[model samples]
Target: MLKKIGFVGLGTVGKHMAENLAKSDYALTVWDEDAEAAAALGKLGVKVGSSAKETAKGQDLVIVIVPESEQIVFGAEGVLEGIDPGTIFVDMGTHCPETIERMSKEAVKRRAMFLEAPVWGSKEHAANGLLTILAGGDEALLGRCREPFSYFGLNIIHIGKVGDATRMKMIVNMLQAELLVSLSEGLVMGNKMGFTPDKILEVLDSGGVASPLFHSKGRSIARGDFSRNLALKYVHSQLERVLEAAQKFGLELPAAETARKLYAQADADGRGEEDFSAIIKLLRR
Candidate 1:
């Protein structure tokens, strides 16, 4: 029953999520550093707030989806400054678990609730309201926010308490990075061995290893079209975080480490803003 919503961050995926929320019965107010992005949402009946703090005031719920944790949680005009007591704040960005835990503690001190609810899937999924939400924090707070989540999330999994969702997301991204690298390597090997990319895709699709990710990204890879479904730089950042988390537990992820290098290479080559699938370019070279 959390009706009044304050939404921050209007990036590639965040804008679509805010648009979905606007379609719901809730009253929505949004703020972003990009005036054009905020103005675009204004046409859809979403009120534009001058700052993050201004957006949080009077809101029953505040949702943040920025690229970094500090952008929404820290600063003079941050969400924390304007959030009223009893307001539930959901951060749906992939960030450091330790950072999320620290922010959660701060929210509690202010009598506000904070939930880490990072999502799975790309911009396309956000646009279609089919993203999978991995939630952490109190179950009761999650229950109260379920209605708004339904607008943009097809599946909502409550992983555990605060910080757990971020840990899970890092693990998920670790596997995802490995898979993309494997796909690229396989395609490169196939091309070098006189096999067509389409043939390789067809064979993979006919096997148990086939997945929605492979099918969608595979087609894009075959056509040499890596047009930014998910940015390569962000995927690289996630891989770095995953490795950091693994190192903290005295474990090493060799495959993820390898994939991370390839992504890093892609970013260094000025393809950072391209689709993560663009890592295939490294293999192609």
Candidate 2:
């Protein structure tokens, strides 16, 4: 039920979310470092702001979807600079928990409410308005923003404090990477056994062991289609964080580590911008 929403960062996920919000009744303004991105959103009836400071000025709510956490909090004229006190700020970027806490404290000091609502799912899900949102901060605040959040996400989960949503988002992304890489390896192994990947998928589809992921990415991976819906490099970064978290807990996560290496190998092969299914490219190579 926000009157005005200012958004920063309109990359793959941010752009579509902003588009959906623009189609709504809320007055929307957006700013991105890329001029082309700003112009693109402008076409959707969104007012393109000149700077991050200008974007946040006098807005009831502000959203930051930049990739790098630094850009969201402390980049040149970051969100903290121009957002008015008492305005609700929601960050949908995947940032470190400590960093999110620090930024949240600063926002609180300025009398603004900060919510970390990092999302799960890729660009395809964003475009489909089916992404799963992991929201953190006050429950009442999340309730107030539910309508705007639902404009672009189907599943909205309110986790814990200001940074818990980011941690949960990383966990989900880590699992997604592991599952995708495992699916890629399984397809490669099936191919080696003289089984066509399509045939394997047919058999797996009818069993309880199969998942939507296997049927979706499985076909693309088998066909070696490494397009850029979900970039392999971003998944690799999530895996790195997962591994570090696991080590901190003294837990053994061998499968996740192996999957991380495959994603890293795929990224190293210059398939960084390709879909997570591109891990199959590394396996087949």
TM-score of 1: 0.97
Candidate lDDT (C-alpha), each: 0.91, 0.84
How close to the true structure is residue 27 of candidate 1, measured as C-alpha lDDT? Answer: 95
lDDT (tens digit, per residue) of candidate 2 on 113-190: 998898877777888899888989999999998999888999998898777888887778877887787777788898
Minimal lDDT window, size 10, model 2: 67-76
TM-score each candidate: 0.97, 0.95
Residue pairs whose backbone atoms clash in candidate 1: none
lDDT of 1 by residue, 115-162 (tens): 999999988999999999999999988999889999999999999999
